[model samples]
Target: MARTLLIAGTASHVGKSTVAAGLCRHLADRGVAVAPFKAQNMSNNARAVPRATEPTEAGEIGVSQYVQARAARTEATTDMNPVLLKPRGDGESQLIIDGEAVENVGAGEYYEAGWERAREAARKAYSRLAAEYDVIIAEGAGSIAEINLADRDLANVETARFADADVFLLVDIERGGAFASLYGTLELMPEDLRDRVVGAAITKFRGDPSLLESGIVEIEERTGVPILGVLPYDDPGLPQEDSVSLPAAGETALYGDSSEVRIAVPRLSRISNFTDLEPLAREPGVGVAYGPPETVLEGADAVVLPGTKNTVDDLLELRTSGFGERLRTFSGPIVGLCGGYQMLGERITNAAVEGTGDEATVEGFGLLPVETHFSREKRVERVEREIRGVGPLAGALGRVTGYEIHMGETALTGPADRPFRDEGAATEQVFGTYLHGLFENRVAREAFLDRVFEYAGRMRPESHAEPSPYERAGALVADHLALDALGVSHENMSERV
Candidate 1:
């Protein structure tokens, strides 16, 4: 029996994904061979996985499951994500199956056909992983309580049904209605599915589990389901899913107490492509934190000026917050990616498109004399280029593929002033370029982090532990499943759901 676990949320931000990832991490540490799953996830954050047998649409994979794969130490994103949806503006989304896009369809019509297709895709994907790992921990879509919608083609309950998922987990905590949310979600799920639910968990609990002990009892009494556990919030080993979603590195540090070394990243309104600091957080003596612009990056190692969707607006805010000037004089290694890269330059074009039907340009910080233009043809493909001379990053980018969903084309003012011939990995202090997942390249992480530590006046610790992200993600899934009231173990990974 291949055991399958489902983590359904009480509400959107009730810590479903975060909780699930943590569980996966713990399980992997326990030597449980685990795989992470999510039936359907809706987000623009996607990744490239080439190992899947059945070809889906290229550029249609969500990076959410990829996060779980990393935690579990899995390498193939295709093996983890078989179906993905990238939403386009007006009521329609791009359908990506098995890692490739077949076509774009209206949301309603897609739902009319996406479930069975998604189930088949996920099941097949899971089957491949199941052969390799012992257990698969899955995540559910929006509130299972969302009745009318789930019936159509939502992957949550449908996954439980089709995947033969053995255990169901209700993640309820953040929103005050956790108790009701859990009970209600359980009650609304199909009876057979409900019976299969292993247990309910109170995740992301803040104060104390004792505070909710009584409520837990009442919950068990009402649903006839056991309260598996109340997991206290641990601040370590957690990575930010996407830049828009603020990342809390578990505030985890491997060999240090970073109470002394502090780093500040702006809480930008529309921040994008912020996976930059994953490498630093894994450094032995480093600590990463997010804060407002008021905090002087003083006594801090460096400041990261991440990317923004609307550069003009975010740049204006950066100037207003005085971070713009601060960056110029920060005297440390200041770096930016994509939109952030544009801001560090002379000016950014496309300001006119802010609201008016006109195209416009906005002056950048003028640090790098590069100009960018917005074009109709957006580059959304995997890119590979060699870094010339910026920092210690001078090497051939070996399949250093990353997605480029940007509308900007950059041109350096002169030959000597190119921002990025490749992607900015080799740039010294004040480097900016349009590349995502820059550190995903082992060479990039080493090159960038080495320069970064030197700029911070610290010796890069030799004992640095570069995390095998997919492995950590998988272990977390397994831990959650074991703690799950369902008592799922590696031996049961073959169980239907």
Candidate 2:
């Protein structure tokens, strides 16, 4: 059986995922067969993993777990994330058990009835992985000391207990209450669970480590917890687990030059698979700013509607927030992916697929001459399709590769020209497709950006696509953490694995 180490945060987005991923890489480098486990994950950013039922194809898992598995040099599986709750809207989410979407459930009903079944599923998955690997690194969700929800918090307390994991609690110094938060969390933790915590680490610190030494010493003396390490504020280019990690709009200028092409993405309430924006954000001379609906679309070269968990609800949100009206009036290059693609259609039928409701048909943005109908079956597959651009995007044509995870089928309502042959539809400057990672393919990405640059009266800058974000993240984790005290030997670390 494999030993376990659980990374629990003082609160959400305090770098638990980063630490866990780093540990997975560090341990793998030691020639240990390691794997990552999360009892539950609530995120829209997900990746396809190998399915146990179908060994040849891929199934869905939280993106963090998928990336962690890659860092560990192991094939990702649904067992890594047993319960995935993708928030739809209005206190409801789609429940996924072991890579399969089970049903759309409300929070009240889920806690009252569904949690036990989901928890049991997680236990079984963790047990299987424990038997197969040498080490299992588990990640916790939110604050581990939320006494109100502790009994039901699968990621923190239940995971630690089930896996017998040595716990490492992480606090974010950037949040300005590190000492108090850590103390309060430790004090609130159930006595037995508190004993499981062997150490604590401060993350996102910005300054000299020696300055924190005095405070760290005092906190350590008070709580009897050793400070493992103080990680610097370095954006190691890992995919953020949630929207909370997103910076406020205009926090960083999208471009240094006023003439550079700037693209605006509406920060939808239920945005999913946001990694689609990462590739575009990495391009030189292009700035990607996530703005709220009404304001984000103003003064931009182009607008992109990202994937959403609940198309109908988020679309409704757009209407309520006046973005739909703005989208209709805005005369600029527009792109929609996945749920966004569904929203640009004339209408959405079978709304009950999103939840238990009588709202069967919801009107879309009517930007494209297509209609969508939701179905019980979800289309989840990796695709490599050749695409040719149309209208103002005529120059943007190439072989695009991406994965699709969506419900509903989109069909043309009229005799309109299709984009990318039969895979997508477009009209003038407006385009829609079910493909995420639309900008990751260099050929397609450069072409689309070139069109935007042309429209904005600026030459498209050279592509500076760097190394894989996962490799950079692993290296950062291995460099930042003091592995020796954490029972990982650094001697010949790169050579051992």
Candidate 3:
């Protein structure tokens, strides 16, 4: 068994992932064999690392592992995103273990069948990663302070004690309820496990970090635990893996120069498996921006409709948000994967699944000659196969390998005359499929970029694809943290007898 330190947050988005990654990288900088783990993650921004060989398990994936890989200073995406869940609408999640789809299970539906089974899944993954490392830093999900959800939640307070992990609690001071968050957390903490915690932390501080002294005093006086390092908020430059249902309406990089190729992604509700665009965002001339549904798509060479957790709800939301109108009117090349593919269809029959908080067969925009339905059987695992010509996906129809993790299945409504070499044409303006991470491959990437480049009326550089910026950024953080010694390394673990 490896020495494990489990981190939990007072609430969501308090930078738990950031702290875990930082510590792993910080410790690994000293040559320590350290890894990161998250037993259950609800984020839809799944990254398919070709390196993970384990069978994809249901409702399991590790985005934090990517953070640890960076900390360990390695270029292994698979070592991080080993288990993934690309959610399909109707409370059913597309369970993927080790980059492969297994089946779909609804929220609180399959767990009743077994808890030992889920624990075993985590144990197996932990064991596999433990074999290659010395210390494993684990992260827990959501607020651990919720008394009602303690036992049922797999990644809650009980899990920390069950795993026999050293606990580190984090509170987001920026949320304006720091005192309440800290007090409530300690009050709700299980008595037997209170002693297990080594320290509590403050995250996302914008103003004077020194102001944390008073907050620390209050928490210590109330909870009787010491404060750990007050991590000053800094941009680690890595994209967040989020499970947000509402579309994020903010632009990061939609503008600079039209001469530079820009990829606009509609900030659709319930977007899942969003990590697909991380590779594109890292490209130099390529820019990835997010914003409100309508405005986000205004200026761009190519627009991407990413995967989603709830496709119907998101489409309904897109319609309400005025984005659906813009999408139909937009002339630029549009590409969609998984849930996004469902949106570009003639109809999405909700007879099997209800995503928009309703249980009715909703109407879909008659774009692509296709329709979709939520299925009990999920396609979760990875497939390194060819994507043939269909719809707007003609010239680029070639062999490209990626994973398929979605709950809904889509088929063309009718056969077309325009002989799509790989298949029949759904239409000319829209292209979609069950595949994720289509642009990671060189040939497919170049073809996609060529379309964007032409749309932008500019020529792309000769060398199009390159290494991800996260690798470079991770390496930089690793080097910087190495200066301050924390005593964690492969050699530090045992004498080389």
Best by TM-score: 2
Comparison by TM-score, 1 against 3, better one? 1
Candidates ranked, most accurate by TM-score first: 2, 1, 3
The 0-to-1 C-alpha lDDT of every candidate, in the order given, reads 0.63, 0.82, 0.64
Candidate 3's error at 91, in angstroms? 6.6
Q: For residues 22-88, write the lDDT of model 3, one tens digit per residue.
A: 7666666567777777766666676545444433432225555654566667644343443455556
lDDT of 2 by residue, 1-497 (tens): 77788999889989888888888887776688889999999988887666655656766788899879988889889899989988776777889888888888998898898999999999999999998987888999999999999889898989998898888889999999898999999999988889988888899989888998899899999999888788888776666777776656434335223348788888877888888877777777778878777688778888888998878878887888888888898777888999988888899998877734578898889999999988878887777888787754566666877778998899999766676667778888888899877787877777678778888888776655576666666676667666665554545333332
lDDT of 2 at 189: 94
Per-model TM values vs. the true structure? 0.74, 0.90, 0.73
Name model 2 segments beyond 4 Å from true. Answer: 56-58, 247-259, 352-360, 389-399, 416-421, 465-467, 490-497
Model 2 RMSD in Å is 3.2
| Model 2: how far residue 249 lies from native, Å | 11
How does residue 366 of candidate 1 score in lDDT?
74
lDDT value, candidate 2, whole model: 0.82
In model 3, which regions exceed 4 Å deviation? 26-31, 47-62, 65-132, 177-180, 207-226, 245-262, 284-296, 299-301, 316-325, 347-375, 386-400, 408-429, 442-447, 458-497
If both were scored by lDDT, which would come out higher, candidate 2 or candidate 3?
Answer: 2
